[model samples]
Target: MSRAFNFCAGPAALPEAVLRQAQAELLEWGAERASVMEVSHRGAAFEALVAQAEADLRSLMGIPDDYAVLFLQGGATQQFALLPMNLAAPGQGADYVVSGHWSQRAVAEGEPHVRTRVLVDAADAAGLYLRAPEVDAAAVDPDAAYLHYCHNETIHGVEFPAVPDSGAVPLVGDFSSTILSRPLDVARFGVIYAGAQKNIGPSGLALVIVRRDLLERAGQPRARVLTWAAHARAGSLLHTPPTFSIYLAALVFAWLREMGGLEVMAAINQRKAQRLYHAIDDSEGFYRNPVDPASRSWMNVPFWLHDEGLNAAFLEESREAGLLALKGHREIGGLRASLYNAMPEAGVAALTDFMGDFARRKG
Candidate 1:
């Protein structure tokens, strides 16, 4: 049986090649007659797997030797609190660029733990999130612990086309929805984190890349599990880690490396997004993407049908046509097509073709 093209925001699509490989090794991962999940994380087999994973990820991202990559549990949402807890000193504030729902949540989570300063809130007068606001470098507080921003706003379909200028402040990014979809300058940020469910692998794992120097700045966290230093000290094996998720993520990293890493992936992703956006743009007022063109997200594209009454029918037909998870979030009812790395060009082509056909019939 063939697989359907999945457009889920998370726990999303993974490379079919990786899935097949995992299926082949489900019972025995190597010479050891046990699956990767069954093996002790402390064992040599798992250790080697993790090391290779880190190496491949580093190579793929061009991560520096001065940075430490930690494969952690809990999703990116957990980091909302942990980041401020670990990075900020008593009474010290962190600056945030509130572009959409996730960034707003990060600020709310950090407020009780530390002083949270809003640098730029991108919402319009109606509180609608539609663009990435421009940052004034002069307004950023130099004494702030770090300047935090979401690399991509998954829900709002907004993305920072380039890294924001932080001036003297160290940049921190929540890259959950955008990581590995393109090349990133790891050296520009104090920390970068992503949940492994989207482009990486499955849920239950978050990958954090932190600059070595900044690790010492981590204060006593509210909990031991929340400390970046502790996780770094134990090599992300502080406790029983998410073994299966990490193993799957390792497979993804290897798969990414084989596909010529992020540089190649970026080009493919760009083309996929372009084709879909063209379909929407050429729909002759039948569909609309509200996001600012400059801040449009390459990974997630959300568009609305002019006739809202047609949404259910559109989604039903899309699902029947082997395009799954095309329904947008309930908060913002429309349609969203998440074009993660694993979503092939063929999927985008099929979706665009369907959209064109549907528009011609219904318009």
Candidate 2:
């Protein structure tokens, strides 16, 4: 059977070429006798793998040398708790801008560790959840440890065109859903983290690129294991790293480079999003996207059917038509098409064709 276009928000699609290469090299990576998963991470080959991956990432994002890149475990969800644990001193608070479900979850998780001040909530805009809120940087507490936000709210289908300008305060961002989709000025952010599943590679590995100064600030009462300084100093070789996932991500980075890097990827991503959003807009009320047009996400596009009853049928038909994972997130009972870096333009065209037929028949 042929592969279907997978639209899952995370654990999403990976490049076909990368997968094929992995299959070819699974038994022996170059001259090594073992698979990357079977090899010791401390070995020279794996060490080179780690260094190259970091170098590629640094080049792609133009990350400064002063920042340390740590690939840790526990996913982005873990970082929600770890961020506050590391950044927020006991009584010192931090600002959380709730733009959607993920950011709200981050606030909820961080609240126990620190006094969470919700700086902005954009839930009511266009009936969507997290979005780029109308926030005034001056409103945030000057003494707050840092400002945290989710750059792209996956479920709510909202994102910021650029990082929010929060003055002197360090900006921490959850870039899980949208990382590597486009170019970014890494220096603009104090800390940026993302789960590898979305645009990177697979689950189990989470990448955190943090400023060296922030690591010094994570002086928690807990053991050093939770601190970024510990991990960075140890070179992210802590506790048997996710060797396979990291290797896969490295392959993905190489694939991106072969395909002309993030600049070209960004252009393709923007075009793919524009095609689908245009389809939604041209449908004449048959389909609607709830996000504010200006703040809509290029990575994930969530649209609703005019008739609620057709939801199940739409998903079923889409599946039968070889489109996989068209179902929306449970929190939002509508279809969401996540056009991540791995999803091809052909898939978007196929989906638009399906939407056109479904709308003509149902409308």
Candidate 3:
């Protein structure tokens, strides 16, 4: 059977070329005869692989030397707790703009560690976030440790069209879903972190690109293990790392380079999103995406069917048609198609075609 187009939010699609390369080298990697997973993380082979992964990512993202890139375990959720602990002083105020689910989660997780303040809550009258909130640099408290926002919300499908300026206060972003889907200005952010499952590779890994100066802020006292500075000092080799996930991520980074880097990926991604959104809009009332046009997500597109009764049938038929994981997140039930870096243009074409056929019969 052929591979189906997978649109899961995380553990999302990875480039086929990367997967093929990983499969080819799974048995014996490098000049040695052992699998990459079996090699010691501190050993020459794996260490070199990690170095190359960081270098490739640095090149791909144009990260400055002033920033220390750390590949850590425990996903982005872990970073929420660690962010305040590593970047903010105990009981210090940190401003957060709650645009959607993930940003809201970040506030909930960080509140215990710091005086988390809501700078902007983008929810409408019904508590639905259909747009990204306006965040002016003036709104950020000058005395705050940092101003935080999510780059994109996977469930609610609201995305910030531009970086929110935070003036002198360090600007932090939770860039999980939209990390590598396009080019980014690394200089504008103090710390940019993402879960590897969506655009990077697989689960069990989180990538943090933090400015070196911020690491010296002497945040709340915590275990050396939870300290971002400790991890950076050790070169992300302080303990047992997620070897397999890092290996896959390294391959993915290489694949992105071969595909002409982020600029090319951005064009392809925009086209895919535009095509899918056009299909939704052209269908009249058959389908609707409630997100504001200016703030609509290029990575995760969540749309609703006019008739709620067709939800089950839509899922069943979409599956039969080889369009996988069209179900919406439980928090907002409708439909979602996460177009990560790896989903091919052909997949979007096929999905749009399926939508048209389904609507013709069901509308």
Candidate 4:
């Protein structure tokens, strides 16, 4: 059976070549008697796998030696609390820039733990989830523990072109969808966390890259599992880690290395995004993307049919055509095509063809 083009926002598609490689290595890896999934994380083979994954990822993202890369479980969602617990102290506050659904949820998660300050407010704008409000750098608290923001608002289909520049405060970025899609300045962020499902590999693993100085800042009173320092100290092997997910992520890193790393991936991703956006543009409001052109996310593009009643039919037909997960997030009722790193150009072409056909049929 062939693979369907998946546009899922998260727990999303991975590179096909990576999957095929894993299948071949499922029973045994590198002539070893056991699969990567079956190997002990403490064993030398798995240790090398994990280390090599970090090193490859480090090179791709230009991660400096001053950072610790942790392959963890609990997804990026868990980092919402873990970050506040570890970084934000009792008296100090953290600024959260709320651009969309995930950002609002992140603010709520961090509120109880510390003094939560809203940086970018978009609450008054009706149905404008796709545009991030312009941030005022002067208004940011210089003494704040960390400034948090979602690099790509998955639900809203918005993205910040560059990381927010808040003076003296380390930036904590939730890069769940856009982690490896482009080259990133790892040094700019105090911490960056990403779920493995989207651009990296399967679900169940979250990769967190934290600056060494930030990890050494202070420890919390919670269980050892909750502290980034504890996890870092154990080399992300504290207790039973997500062995399978980590291994798959390693495979993906290897595949990325083979494809000339992130620089090449960025170009391909840009071409794919431009093609899809052009399709949306040519529709002449027959279908409309709500996001501001500058703030639009390359990973997920949500657009609406002028006739809302046609949504169900569009999804049904799209599935039949082997285009899957084209439904937008429920909170913002429209269609969303998450063109993650794994989505091939042909898949986007098929979706564009389907959209054009659907529009004509509706008309």
- Candidate topping TM-score: 3
Per-residue accuracy of model 2 over 1-363 as CA lDDT, tens digit each: 899998888899999999999999999988898888898989999889999999998888889999999999989999988897888888989999988898999999888888899998886736557458876889989999889999999988999977898899999999999999999989888899998999999999999999999888854577777888889998888668899999999999989988898999999999999999999999999999967788999999999999989999899999999899988889987899999999999999999999999998888
Ranked by TM-score, the better of candidates 3 and 4 is: 3
Model 4 regions more than 4 Å off:
none
Q: After superposition, how far is residue 62 of candidate 4 from its true place, in Å?
A: 0.8
| TM accuracy, model 3 | 0.99
lDDT per residue (tens digit) for residues 1-363 in model 4: 568888988889888888888888889887569887677788888888788888888888899999999988888878888888899777778888888888888888877788899977665546466576776778788878888888998888889987888777888889999999989988888999988888988888889999988887773567888888988998888888888788888888888888888999899889889989998889978898867899888998988888899989999999999999999888987999988878988999999999999888886
Which ranking of candidates, highest TM-score first? 3, 1, 2, 4
lDDT of 3 by residue, 13-103 (tens): 8899988888888889977798888999989888999999999999999999999999999999999999999988877899999999999
- lDDT for model 3 comes to 0.94
Query: How many clashing pairs in candidate 1?
Result: 0
State which candidate has the highest lDDT. 3
lDDT of 1 at 317: 97
The TM-scores of all predictions, comma-separated, are: 0.98, 0.97, 0.99, 0.96
Provide the overall lDDT of each model, using Cα atoms, as 2-decimal numbers: 0.92, 0.90, 0.94, 0.85
Tens-place lDDT per residue, model 1, 137-247, is 889999999999998999999999899889988899999999999999999999999988998999999999999988888564467778888888988888999999999
In lDDT terms, how accurate is model 1?
0.92
Candidate rank order under lDDT:
3, 1, 2, 4
Task: Score candidate 4 by TM-score against the native.
Answer: 0.96
Candidate 3 stretches with Cα past 4 Å from truth are none
